[model samples]
Target: MYRERASRVVGGAVVWESVSDGVAPVRVLPDGCVDLLWSSRRGLLVAGPDRTAHLSVSGPGERWVGLRLPPGAAPAVLGVPADELRDRRAPLADLWGPSAAAPAERAAAGRPAAVLESLARDRLRAAGGADPLGARLTARLATGVPVAAAAAEVGLGARALHRRCRHLFGYGPKTLARILRMRRALDLARAGVPLAEAAARAGYADQAHLTRDVRDLAGLPPATLLLG
Candidate 1:
């Protein structure tokens, strides 16, 4: 149900196959590159190399405004209320909305700065007071530490961390950590390193752990994408 494609906009070439109609909890692998996701009724969700997720709904139609957020910007932007956007029938749509065109147009127009400013304004309005635990957790995630250890390091219990992460990032901390780790692994793989090496460098227990993380996040085995 979920589909994805890696493409080069300026070159106008389909660099990767598109993932279509994905089910909930889709795993997007680390590809050593970034992407701008657009769906007809699902709006837009921009994911970063650090496993940050940003969701936004398009006004209507195919016109979209692209916002190239800085790394670590998701926590700040995912401030919108879930119920206010769309029905939770489709988790993707509920996270984003049904307007994918605005971002496309913004990208074509080359006004990413302006688009980000607008998104920031909207986020500020939706976000409640900042959650310090979320900030601390993100910092630990960046280091590729295990979530359990990270939670303890931040003086938060596992359940408390999970609740706060869901409230802030729309997913659990473990999910975010996997995404982040996969992203890091992909970076190493793309750099021409061995998969096993990349996995270890990214903090996986071993190559198998790395493979599981990559498969869970990217929906493809690490070797398939990187080695093939």
Candidate 2:
């Protein structure tokens, strides 16, 4: 079973939990987000932004809880550049040290998801909150704005924009654009929109184009993911 909800402790973050029972590996699609996780088997961990889907398998009956930080919000709380942690999972102790990880893993309420959010909230405050640039960039691309136009609107030339985006989002804006476009298309399709119409609404060249992108980024076709 898996479920998620908006976080009370961290703005724009989602708290999710999943319990596995030896089913097939789960395909975790990329959505330009980072995660702070606690595994019943592994203790505290950090999941970095992904350029493509990640296949994850936990032991049977294992419980997993996580805080999914929206694009660009993780760096402030993690005290690490997003790019440095991209495409990988590391123990929280690796980033925050054993002592720091211990207290969070043993948070007061004994609820892993709540503890994760509280930890991120405290760390985010210490770091002065997430960069406002993240919201601006996400807003533009999510509406299907062209990357160059978005960059120009943000007052950054190509190189500067790329540099900042690499740090803030773990990838350049163009890649973020693609991820956002795929997400938009999938959401529409999941809502029962026709494939062709969803593609167009999401700025794809055609339904075929949307299929290719979904396969590439999510490791599945649109129909399969929608069914999933």
Candidate 3:
């Protein structure tokens, strides 16, 4: 079973928990976010942003909880560039050493989601808060704005924008825009919009364009995603 709720401590973040039953693998699609995950079996790890889909495997009855941080938000809390963690999952202990072990210990006691949120809240405070630029870029790009236009709106030149995106989002602005657009299309489709209409509304040239983009990022076409 899988469920999720919005995080009160982190803006644009979600608190999610899953219990695997060994039925099938889970397909984790790109979402332009990073996750701090705690597994009953594996303890604490950080899931980085992905440029494409990720397949997750778990043993039956394994419980997992995660605090997912919005794009541009995690680099500050994790104290590392987003690009460093891209397409990777690293133990929290590897990132913060002994300090990271405490949260895992506390989470094991119970109320894992609350424990995770407190950790995020504390670390975010210590880091002087998540990067505002990440929120800004996310807001602009999510609206389907062109990368150049988004960069100009954010007061960044091309090279500067690419550098900032790599540090904060783990990809260049063009890739970020494409991923965001793909997600938008999926959301619209999920809302019962037809693929053609969803594609057009989400900034794709047409349904065929949407299919190619979705397959590139998610390894499945829109219809398959909606079926799930």
Measured by lDDT, the strongest candidate is 3
The candidate with the higher TM-score, 1 or 2, is 2
User: In candidate 3, what are the lDDT values of residues 102-132, reduced to their tens digit?
Assistant: 8889988898889888988888999999989
Task: Report the lDDT tens digits of candidate 2 across residue range 1-228.
Answer: 989999865567899999998678988899999998888888888897999999998899988999999898888989999998899999888887866656554842378876787788888889988998987898899999999999999999999999989998999999999999999999898888999999999999999999999999999999989887
Q: Return the TM-score for each candidate structure.
A: 0.56, 0.95, 0.97
Clashes of each: 26, 0, 0
* Pairs with steric clashes in candidate 3: none
Better of 1 and 3 by lDDT: 3
lDDT of each: 0.52, 0.89, 0.92
Local error of candidate 1 at 149, Å?
2.2
Model 1 stretches astray by more than 4 angstroms? 1-65, 68-113, 125-132
Model 3, poorest ten-residue lDDT window? 1-10
lDDT of 2 at 51: 96
Candidate 2 matches the true fold with a TM-score of: 0.95
Q: Candidates ranked by lDDT, best first?
A: 3, 2, 1
